[model samples]
Target: MSSKEVDVQQVLNTVGEPTRFRIIELLSSRPHAVGEVATALGALQPQITKHLQALEAAGVIRVHRLGRRRVARLDRETLARVAAYLGGLARADEDDAALDDYQRAIAREETRLAEGDSTRVLRFERDLPADARSVWEAWTNPARAAQWWAPRHFSVRVFDFEPRAGASIRIVLAEGDAEYESRGHVERVGAGRLVFSLAPVDPAGEPLFEARHDLVVTGEDRAHVRLDIEISAVREDAAPAVAGLRPGWEQLLDALDAFLRTTP
Candidate 1:
């Protein structure tokens, strides 16, 4: 029979037989010759051979010739396939449970929002270069933002960017051949504070999140300025994104600091 015609359930059923089950139980501990299997089960060699043949045909056990002796062992690939199938089924069940929980949370949040409840806010703060205009221009200028905005593995592509309020900006990040885009409108712009709302350009981008940034110029020199920043975003699950942002933001700020120190 073709391998596809050999049903996994049929193999399981064949191995479930009393004699075959005992043989499998014995082999579970260790591989053994047909004679050893017979001796362990207190059966004749021929009787063990019959069960062994059936198991081998069902792809449950494999027999290898060793000189004058034949050794049998469980077919590891078949056993692994069975285990993986069961694991996938369990994962599917767990996903169903999580989906139900998410649906309930959404319904509860909707009811709360209908009553005009506000969103939960998560916050972060940082210190930047001492130059106010430099920090402002670094953040507002597409060229400067592109230099340090993205993570190490990503490069930014800013197609349309205007620092003025109500202008639209589209930023694309490229990682190898994979790309992610953020599309949003500039909501507010102050002396050193900028607020925006960004949504992923594609359906595959992360769910809705908000970006709020506040840059405060702390001090200045003839050609240098000190600035501090408070960047806050509301993400679906803030923990992982927050953790990732910590390092990325630090690196970007470091790059910006270096750029300002050397730039004329």
Candidate 2:
């Protein structure tokens, strides 16, 4: 086998072990000395050092001398090259089956988890010269909504939208080839408040996940909107979804503020 092939196999074999996987996970966060990693893993320092040396040989990790201690960290560049190679292989018919199987196994594991309710609420108050009707029109209007929906790194496309009760809205966000859809029926529409349920839709327009949004115009010349977003599947997973949503909601509120400021 070629040297590159040998290195690839070596990396796969080393990381296939549970202990080595843990070591990589730790090193990915920050560089660690052999002794520190050993202590963290409750293993002998010698065993940790051996694994580190093997990882280094496989080009999966890099070691730097830190005075008396040697610090090790993940070699991200090397890993990126490995990932690119894997993606190329995945495009091949023979390798696609293995990738499909791995994905199916992950999906099965995710499905087995008990469902829970994970809801995040964000409220914002903003002043605008536009009346409630105008504001509502700006929000539900495709052209106006796209102008400020995602201020950074996202573009919105609305195919269908109506602001009245029992009407549905569909919006697609584009970032590269990655597309996300939000669709739902308008549940309530008051003098200044509009409540709706939004669920992500697949490419075929099937609901992927559901969330609720409540926009209340708490004061005239100003409006207060609160979005109550709940994802059943992600609620069960908890950690990642919770961590991601906290900042995400804050950013969305910021986007709304920008939108209100720009809208007449």
- List clash counts for every candidate, in order: 6, 0
Give the TM-score of each candidate. 0.44, 0.47
Ten-residue region with minimum lDDT total, candidate 2: 237-246
lDDT of 1: 0.67
Alpha-carbon error at 118 in model 1, in Å? 11
Which number leads on TM-score?
Answer: 2
lDDT of 2 by residue, 1-264 (tens): 233644666778888888889999998889998888999999999898888888888888989987987989998877777777788777757335544755564454355443333333444455554556667766766677667675356677555767788997776777778877777888887666678877666667766545677776544455545455544444343343234343445555667666776755
TM-score, candidate number 2: 0.47
lDDT of 1 by residue, 1-264 (tens): 344645678688888899999998889988999899999999999989999999999888999999999999998777677666667777756446544755665655556445554254434454554456777787788777777677666778664678889998787778899887777777777766677655453365553445444444434542232222232333434333323344545556667777777775
